[model samples]
Target: MKNYIVASWILFIIGISLLTSCEKDPWKFDTDRKPGLYFVELADTNEISFDQLNDSTWTRKLFICYLIGVPVDYERQIEFAPIDSASNMKFGEEYKFSDAILKAGEVYCNVYLWAKRPAVEDEDGKRYCTFRIVENEHFVPYMYSTAFFQVRVNHPREPKWWDAEIFGAWSEKAFQVYMRYYNKQEVENTDNWQKYYSTVYGKNMYIMNDATWEGVPALFLPLLKEDVLVPVFDYFVANPSDGVDIPEWYYEWKKN
Candidate 1:
């Protein structure tokens, strides 16, 4: 009879433990907490040439969501509206997101903005577009953000005289050294060629004006400083096929 009573007590304790275990802490959405997605803005603005648009698609992480310690398992739709009414790009025509649904277990997703190349020209032959992410049922737009992203797509600028012959093919180490030597600013032309005048120390600089050298596409200079002579830029232009070893001039610049 005592054993029976002890067994009953054990069973009762087991039952009480089961009831306590079954009870769970309540979970409520923190209404006071401001949690939502935001534009990562990894790059405030992105620009790509038409050649880069070969695939007719470009991607930008226009939005990132905060992990609110809960999974947003529901299918949510995001709204993309243009701030510029007069912009040339048309929604559902020029560009679109490959997928609009924010899938489950995803903290962030990328908006793949795509557009077709049109055979047309407006003075510059470039198309400009701007977009902003809007709020939806699942999340709200992040505060303290411009909430806007800009895209500029255009054709690649024409190759300059020097670029046509030896832009990347040649080692421009000496030219780079010269820039550092003078502490000069590199001015870019419409053709995107780095152009600037020689420094006072480099007054005898050899300029490459014409396109051809030795009957080949060469770096030619219109102005050659006959009196002053810094043969660094000239030597590389003359010997495009040779490697650019560190010259004594570069060492001199370092000493100062």
Candidate 2:
């Protein structure tokens, strides 16, 4: 009988705690809160991804929700400002946002974002921007914050197991061609190559020390053939970069 009373009390306490936690849970989307404004969007919700060669612009729909017991009698304009310093993609050139309007009797409104590709691909071709509300007459900025957008590039990186012997000494162009032939992309030796090659861009690249590459060569033997290098050499012959013109080693391979 005593155990039953004790068990009942324990259950009662557990139920009270759960009710309290639910009341305080920030993610609990309750409409009965004190009047406030908040964004119903995630940090990466506004991203624009594109292939530089194929795509130019992307349009996205976004939203803002708030708590109000009564319907707003008139339309209210919600304004936003670019977090300028955080924005990498330029305003007039790469992106544009139109002010959104909250119509009468509506709890939410739509926001539109348009993104344009950069004129020339920057090294990684990735850019970012953030936006936040500028308070207006109807309502002010809320607890939940800002909108973020990214123009992120998705280019393949050279595999960790990339050995210069297979690609015939790595050049930016040569690696680009090699990626087409090689199917595997393991993260095993990425750091080893960086240390072994000690590559400095357009400078003292590839300090060929046999000892540095001695132990791991057999384990990470890159797939290669003499003919596969033909396209690599051909790409450079057709289109050479201004600064790091084709290396002599590629030509040497062509002659032999």
RMSD to truth, every model = 16.1, 14.4
Clashing pairs in 1: 204-228, 204-229, 207-221, 208-220, 208-221, 209-220, 209-221, 209-222
Candidate 2 structure quality by residue, lDDT tens digits, 83-113: 8887887776677776778788888777777
Candidate lDDT scores, in order, read: 0.45, 0.56
lDDT of 1 by residue, 1-256 (tens): 9999999999999999888766632464665553466555533354423342232444343344343334566656655566565356676676555575566767666556665554445324356556666666566666432333344444432223333222233334433433343332233221112332442112212333333334322122222111111344455456553555433443453356
lDDT of 2 at 166: 44
Q: Which candidate's TM-score is highest?
A: 2
TM-score of each: 0.38, 0.41
TM-score between model 2 and native? 0.41
- In terms of lDDT, the poorest run of 10 residues in model 2 is 200-209
